[model samples]
Target: MSRALALVFTASFGAMWSFYLLLSVVPRYATSHGAGGIGAGGMTGALMGATVAAELAVPRLVGRFGYRSVLAVGLVLLGLPALALRAATSLPAIAGICVIRGMGLAVLFVAGSALVPAIAPPARRAAALGVYGLVVGVPAVIALPLGLWLAERVGYAIVFVLAGGAALGGLAALPGVPTRTRAHAGAEAGRGVVAALRSPALAWPSAVFSLSAMAAGAVVTFLPLAVARGSGGLAASALFAQAASTAGARWWAGHHGDRHGSAGLLLPAVLLAAVGLSALTLVGRPIAVVLGMLVLGAGFGVAQNASLALMFEHAPPRDYDAVSAVWNIAYDTGLALGGAGFGVLAARTGYPAAFGVAGALVAAALVPAWRDRAWLRPVPDAPHCPRGYR
Candidate 1:
């Protein structure tokens, strides 16, 4: 990797570690503090809702402030408030902290993704993104489960302290990363998520990708709670398997998408998520639970890379920020909806049936995933088009 690209990855590592460490823990924390299932969902919803709200303005922020400034601010926002969680006893106070962190996550998502294509070679962009996935995904694999384990053994206060320190540590790499992407001037300066959504090419893939993200949100937020009581080890193991598989699948999908086509992978990716979620309906079986998560994680990973690579493949270099923002908005929006909606649904229907319904909902998205492949059909002689658009 180029030095600048390495620096971007380094900075992103800290942001992602802090985010994932608290992702599963925060909901559980709320539940422990007497918030109940709905309240747990509310905490996740608040964070993701704030993230979606922040995403809308990030393209403009990056356009005005540049990558380094926005990224630096993002690190602080994501890191600092996590420390305050140790003292927060009320649900509202915790939600307020989550909102600030969510805004920080929005900036990191947009700026971090936009910087990749700007710095990497066009022919190997997806391969480079695979590396980016590893950088981000490693945290989900390690910290996601580790935080839960640490919370059980060490206490939430220590987890909060570690999360804060991880993000603050990323600041040391900021000076090495570039302030602006090469295409950040002129026409690109005015483009935003609205413009990107107006284009069917970007919208279709984003819509398809959102479904998998929804499933992911539900799994991350409720799986531990849904498992048989006192099976905390099982929950942690299932999550670890999910994150590890996701990281591996994402890395593989990026390379494959670069060589073949990202669009073709979208259909299978959605189907896999559906199948995995369906398996979770058999929640009493430990083997089934782990296998289900693994399958689901694989699908989610492929969708992550395929949807993103497809979007970046079609967009002009100048529209990177807008495309990144729109993609991330779809992502976080699905996560918010899934986390909040599933909790309410599960409260009424029970976990098994809720898992079934969530699976069916993801399966319903197949229509869009299938249609997106046609919309993304390859165009000969177009430099921005991918071989797999067909």
Candidate 2:
């Protein structure tokens, strides 16, 4: 990979690691502070809502401030929440920190994603995105388990400090990247969100992204609780297994998307996710849960990379900010909806029924993939391109 691409990946890895670490510890911290399941779930939901709000604003922010400046600000903002969490002794205070942290996550994701496409050559864009996803997945895979372990050994405060340090590390890497300024940067500056909705090509991939995100949200919010029940207690082994499966699957799927066109992989990835959800519904056995988690993780990783690549490839270069906003809105909306809706559903029915409903929703994602497969054809060449032109 090129040096620019490497830097993007490195920065993304650190940022995402910090985000995941906080996510892993938030529930434990909440419970320790006397919050229950509903309260914990609400905090997670609030975080997603905050991210959506930030995503809605990112296009304008990127236009006004530029990507590099936006990213730097985002990294610093991410650090603040960690410090806030360390001092938070009440549910409202913790929720407020989550909201702040969510805003930082929103900015980082949008700026970083938009930056990747600008820095990468068009011909290799998909591959570059795949590599980027792989890098993000690496730290994500370990962040949760490690965070949980550290929290258990040292305490949640220490985990928050470590996560803050990671955010600082990511911020330190940002200055090394060269800034890209678009030609129509002014005209394109405030148009990303609207343009994304108007373009069916961009919207379709986002739909797929949203559905997959929903499945992931379910797992993240409830899998630990489920495991605790199944094991008769919360064991480190279960947490480690879940984190490993998620991270490992993401890394592998990113490579798969890089090798094959995203369209070729979309349906199968969605189907695999559905199957994983189905497995969880059918059998609550520990080994089965682990296996299902692996399937779900792989599907999520591949689908996310593929969908993002598809959106970027179809989007006009000038619309990067808008496109990034659209992608994040879809993803966070899915997460928020899934966490809140599934929590209600699980309460009304049970974990098995909740898993089944989630599986069904994921299965529905394949319909659009099948129908829109041809819509994602490779970009046509300019009239006077090279000899390999078809």
Candidate 3:
């Protein structure tokens, strides 16, 4: 990796850690601050749904403004909500801030992902993205456990303030990167959002990305609660195990994807994830819960990195903004739906049934993996340009 990639990866680390910290704590914070069980979960789901809506709108924002400008705007937007969380005394106010925060997150992720393919060499794109995922994943693994710990030691308000400051730090790194505005100018002029949506390459990966994201969404929203039930107590240990396994898997798979093609890793990744989910059904002991979480996290890391790399591989360079937007929208929408639906289902049938259902859906993802070998053909002799123009 070059210095530029290292900087981007560092920025990603700050941004993701902040984002994950807030996501991990907000539900408990909401409940403690006044909102109850279902309402707290609902607010979390609303945050995710709002992000899906924001992702749908981000491409236009990036087109009109450049990527760096859009990134700056997202950072500002993200920071405000983190600060606002300190003052949110009611459910309605908290929900509103969640929406604002979600929009900011959506813009930041789409812009950042668009920048990744542009910066990486054609042959190294998957590997580069894998590293990017690993950087982001590390914080994700630690964020929840750390947040829970911080909330216990300090307060949620202080946690939000720290998270906001870290996000601002990520914004500070933006100015150092070389710009790609000139290269994207022609594509910006020629394409409309409708034309971008009509492309099969965009739609297919978006669908697959959405499906893969559902499992992760369920874990983020409900896994802690599930662990609590299985253990007859809540343990921070489960969060640590899940995060550690996920970060390790993401780093390993990213390097693997770079050495071998992403297609080579897809089937096994999904299969492992499905197996992990199935294991949840039989987890009656504390050790079993931790083992199940590790399996689940590893599977999610592989699927997430592989799927995103496949999308970039198949997409045209000029379409990076549109592709990132559409793919993220699919992912966020699935996340929201999975979180909300599983929350309700857990209330009805129980965690085991909910985990089983999510597992079944994940298992079905293999159908696409089998067909992806044909679907995601390698890019042929494409010119490598640092400016991101094809």
Candidate 4:
């Protein structure tokens, strides 16, 4: 990996670390403070809602200010706001912090993904992205669980201080990232996200990725509630397994995509996810739940990498920011919608049947994935792009 790319990874790591640290902590904190179930839902809903909105707008800002500037500003917004959370106990105050942090997350995802293709060589671009995914995923694997533990052992105030500081510390890495973007023939990147969505090549992958993302949302959001009453620990373990699998598989998928093509992986990804969902039918069985999660995570990993790499392959470098925004919109919105939808489905049909239906939805993505099968074929034996496409 290049120095610049590595630096971006570092910044992303810190940003994600801070974000994960509060993922579970925030909702519980809100509930304890009198935000009832609906209020807590609003708390997360508001954060993700703002995050999706900002994800769309961030690409435009990247085109104007460059990646480092946008990213630095994001880190500041994400970090500085948390410092204030130490004193704010009301829902409105908490919501405000979530909104600011949500915007920061939007900036980090858009700017960072945009910067990746610009810095990494075309030949290994997918692999580089996988590594990047690993770097960022580490936080979710660690801080997510650690955050709650720290809060319980020490206190929420200390957790708040550390979380904010971790995010703020990422700013130091910003000065090292490049100010310019990868050059392209047209101004497509500046053409707005809606226009990008108009491309069938781009939209298809986004759709497929969204299906899998929805499942990811369901697993994390409802798996705990779906299991036995005292299975909170089991749910956490399963979630961790899924997250770890996704991370490892992402890198492997990128590496495999470089050697073969990403399109071929699409059908398999959906199928794997379906199998994983099928295993969830046996959710009452702890081992079955873990196994299903692992399989599903692997599928999700492949889908994530393939969709991203294929989108990048088709689009000119100029469109990277827009591409990033579009893919992330799929990610955040899918997660939000999946969690919301699955909740309703579970209430009506029960967890086991709901999971089966969720799998069916993911399987349905295969039709669109099939259409892109031929598109992802890499040039034989002679893999890797010759050089940077300036």
Candidate 5:
């Protein structure tokens, strides 16, 4: 990797560490401090809602302020708020802090994702993104489970402090990264969110990806509580399995899609996610829970890489920011909806049954995925670019 890409990856590592370390812990924190499932889920919803809100504006921010300034501000916003979380006991206070952190996460993701393809060669674009996915995934694999383990032993305050410090520490890498790339320097760059949303080429892949993202959101937010009590170790192990598989699958998918065309993978990816979610309906079985998460993670990983690669193939370099914005919006909005909506649904239906319903909902996305596949199919005799080229 080049120096600039490595720096971006380094910054991303810290940001994701901070975000994932507290992802499940914060919601559990809300519940422990006199809140119900809805409150816990609302914490996630508030965070992701703020993320989507910021995603809508991040391209403009990057355009105006350039990447270095925006990224530095993002790290500060993400890290500083968690330092106060140790003292904030009320649900409202916790939710408020999450909102600020979410905005910071938005800037980090939007700017970083846009920069990857801009920095790398087009032929290797998906592979570069695969490396990026692996970088981000490592934090989720380690910190997601470790936070809960640490909270159980050392207490939430320590975890919160660690989370805050991780993000703040990423500031050291900024000097190596450029303020803006040539792709982002033009006046016409980063202004196509609405236009991208309007076009079917972008919309179909986004819709397919959103389905898996919603399932992932629900899994990460509520999986610990969904399993039988005293299964904290099981929850941690299961999450580790999920994150590990996701990282591996994302890398494999990127390379495979680059060679074979990403469109063909979307249908199978959605179906795999549906099957995995359905298995979660049997929460009493430990083997089933672990296996289910593994499968779900694989599907989620493939969908994540394939959909993103396909979208970038459809658009030019100048629209990378807008494309990243649209993709991130779909992802975060799906998370918010799943976190909040599943809490309400789970409250009434119970967790196992709720998993079944969620599976069915994911399966409903197959129609769109199939449509996207048909639309994105490449002509057989056309000059070969990448497999995903029109």
Candidate 6:
């Protein structure tokens, strides 16, 4: 990573760390305040709902305020509000905090992502993105479980301050990144998400990415419950493996993607994640569970890097903000939808059957992945650039 990109990655890590630290903690916090399991789940739902809403609007916000300004405001919103949680322990107040913080999450990701295409070295952009994914994905591996562990021993208030501070601390890194908005000749005209969706090249990658994320949602949400008894601690180990594998595979995907078109990686990744999710139906086998998540994570990582790289490649330099917003929207929304829907299906069909169904759903995404293979072929012409560049 370049020094500038490293700073952005650090900021990304800090922001995501705060987000994941509270990911599981908030649910239990709600239950302590007399909320049932359903209420705990509702808190997460509310947070995601707010996050998606904010992500859609952030492109416009960045256009006006610049990345540094909007990102600073987002960091403050994400970090500062947690300090107030001690004063207002009511469920309503808690939910309100989540809403405000959710907007901050939206801004951080969109701004951070837009920065990637601009600052990354052109030839090794995929590898740079792999580095980006690794740093950012660390929170999911560490903070998620650690937050709950710390909350039990010390107290939620301490955890809240630390989490908030992690985000706020990132302000030091912000000054290093360029805040200048883009000035591509046609950038303004093609500025919105709607315009991005109208382009098949941009839209299809997001569509396929959402499908891979659906299984990721189910795995992270249900794996522990699915293997409660016999799997030894391998289930948790598997999760760690999954996170680590995803981080590593992202780098590898980028390396190979640069050599052999990124779009070619999509179908193979779908196949891998599908197999892993299918194996998850064998809930009793420790090895299967471990290997399953490992493979699934690898595929998910590949999908993450490939789809994002493809989006940046096909879209003009001008549309990076819309591209970032759309990608982040797809990322969070898919993960949320996957978890929510899988829970319902699992209730009716049981974990094994539900997991199998999830696998089938991912496999079905292969159809779209296959169609998008055209992305591997050389472009007939580059619309955004001149003839010499094409």
Query: Highest lDDT among the candidates is held by which one?
Result: 1
Q: Better model by TM-score, 1 or 5?
A: 1
lDDT of 5 at 254: 84
The global C-alpha lDDT for each of the candidates, from Candidate 1 onward, is 0.89, 0.72, 0.71, 0.79, 0.87, 0.77
**Each model's backbone clash number:** 1, 1, 1, 0, 0, 0
Cα lDDT tens digits for candidate 2, 1-390: 667667777777778888878774786688788976666667778888899999888878777666678888788888867876888999999989889988988998887888777777665666566666667666666786677678777888788988887886887677776555553444534455875788777787787778877877777766666564445234344445545555555555445544555556666766777778767774457777777777877777777777776676666777777887888888888877776677778877788888987798789866866776665664545321111222
| Stretches of candidate 6 exceeding 4 Å from the true structure | 28-41, 83-94, 151-158, 181-189, 229-235, 368-390
Instruction: Tell me the tens digit of each residue's lDDT in model 6 across 90-142.
Output: 88988898888888999998889888777775666666777788787788777
- The alpha-carbon lDDT assigned to residue 275 of candidate 4 equals 82
For model 6 the local lDDT of residue 299 reads: 91
In angstroms, the error of model 4 at 193 is: 1.2
Residue 29's lDDT in candidate 5: 93
Query: What tens-digit string does per-residue lDDT give for candidate 3 at 11-43?
Result: 667778778888757877877877644666677
Clashing pairs in 2: 192-322
lDDT of 5 by residue, 1-390 (tens): 899999999999999999999999999999999989888899999999999999988888888898999999999999999999999999899999999999999999889999998898777888888898899999989999999889888899999999999999999999898888988766775556888788676788788888888888898899988988899998898889888888888888888877787777776887888888889999889999999999998998898888888788777787888889889888898888889889998999999999999999889867755644664655444332354453
Where is model 5 more than 4 Å wrong at Cα? 372-374, 378-390
* lDDT digits (tens) for residues 38-90 of candidate 4: 45545556666778999988877876777788899999988988788878899
TM-scores, all candidates, are 0.97, 0.89, 0.88, 0.88, 0.96, 0.87
Among residues 3 or more apart in sequence or in different chains, the pairs in candidate 1 whose N, CA or C atoms overlap within 3 Å are: 261-388
Residues 212-258 of candidate 1 have per-residue lDDT tens digits of: 98999998999989999988899899999999988999999989987
Point out the higher-scoring one by lDDT: 2 or 5.
Answer: 5
Best model number under TM-score: 1
Relative to the true structure, candidate 4 has a C-alpha RMSD (angstroms) of: 3.4
What is the Å distance of residue 30 in model 4 from its true position?
Answer: 3.7
